[model samples]
Target: MEISRRRFSALGAGVAATTLSGTLSGATAAQAETPPGKPAVRNVVLVHGAYADGSSWAKVIPLLQEAGMNVTAVQNPLTSLADDVAATNFALARQDGPTLLVAHSYGGTVISEAGLAPNVTGLVYVAARAPEAGEDFAALSARFPTPPVTSGIITSGGFKWIGRSAFLRDFANGVPRKEALVLYAAQGLLSTAAPTTSVAAWREKPSWYAVSKDDRTINPDLERFMARRMNATTIEVDSGHLSLVTHPKIIAGLILRAAANS
Candidate 1:
């Protein structure tokens, strides 16, 4: 459903904060440095997880560009896990040289699989899910007690899902009240099928993660657990579920670091 204009502005502001916070801290340093010529890295492909779309990365795009990095924010259809991976891989195939694949929320599962792309140089997770073999979103969520907000999204058919008011309660908790309302209003209807991954994708890729300590949708503990398993470089942000939007600069810095290392 489309968000009302007023709500959209609020959501934009909230997401803007999440996307730029990473760069804001080192603003002077980033501004003083010359943009890497041509392309220091081929491209950075951003994948947004469930309940959101490409707009999620709007705030972070400029920062990447300012660093002279080409960026593509994949607009995942959120129909099925494999489909999302294929879409991401298609994006990866179009880029030259090394590429950084970044995922948020459920998007992590997509990157875990799609990251197998030959061009991928690194993987980054922003408060995202990093699943192991045969683990689906439900299985992972089952391992942890259902967070109060998630407990409320009822699915009537197998693998079909809907968000309840709890979407506002959990995912958007720390977001401004007005912005949270916009997010709640604009949130996408995700497929239960989208969260289930067939195999572990990060085993072969160099990876990193940004954990939102106060995230309610996916437990922060789960983020740490997955990061440890992947042997990923980790950074903790004191934000909520939409950390990318709430703390973009931190996320951008991590992405820039990943790009530099790759």
Candidate 2:
């Protein structure tokens, strides 16, 4: 179901307020009792985009955990953008300390709208969509044409997504050929309706964006535009759409930076 512009605006406002409250509360608590020389804080919450589950983060999770930071990956239902946001928020609510909300592919839209969760001190976009209010994936793609690689997707109702071959070619292009093939074979069909995001979180949130210079799915130009508009700390990588998988170290470093700054 498409979220109306008005509804998305309302949701954005509510989420912003919720995030603000959380930020303020955390700040207040931090000021109450803290030694001057505290180590840099690091808490990460990862959100995967459409057609993928939390397992998409499997390759990167251990890396983050190994760095001595707490991490949580939200298993979004990929049902609707709002539903995904709610799931992300639920994960955020369960975390202790501050958080860096990271999004991949369509998860960018989810995090853009839901990053307002109180503990969300910052945001990291990994070759993901960061749409503004009233924007959908189709609208953003139109500005910078991306060769269509979704012809393999099969949907009974209104759901739309990429097929296995398309996933390997477009989504997992720069990844290891063998692993890309494996991921393509194990890919999930996503709800087409979820790409319609109602709110824009970049306008208010401090965000960091990772641009996949070799992305075959989302255009690199659009990634640059979204990052510029959000005034985000931007990092460019020569990877495909699944940079989080192929270049987890780079993505992790950016997340760690954001968490540290937060």
lDDT of 2 at 174: 73
Residue 94 of model 2 has an lDDT of 89
Off by over 4 Å in 2: 1-39
Compared with the true structure, model 2 gives a TM-score of 0.81
Best by lDDT: 1
Q: All candidates' lDDT scores?
A: 0.73, 0.71
lDDT (Cα, tens digit) per residue for candidate 2, span 7-109: 1122211112211222221111111111246554567889987767788888778767876788999988877777888999999888888778899988888
Compared with the true structure, the alpha-carbon lDDT of candidate 2 equals 0.71
Candidate 1: residue 129 lDDT (0-100): 87
Tens digit per residue, CA lDDT, model 1, 199-249? 666898888788788888888888888888888877777788887777666
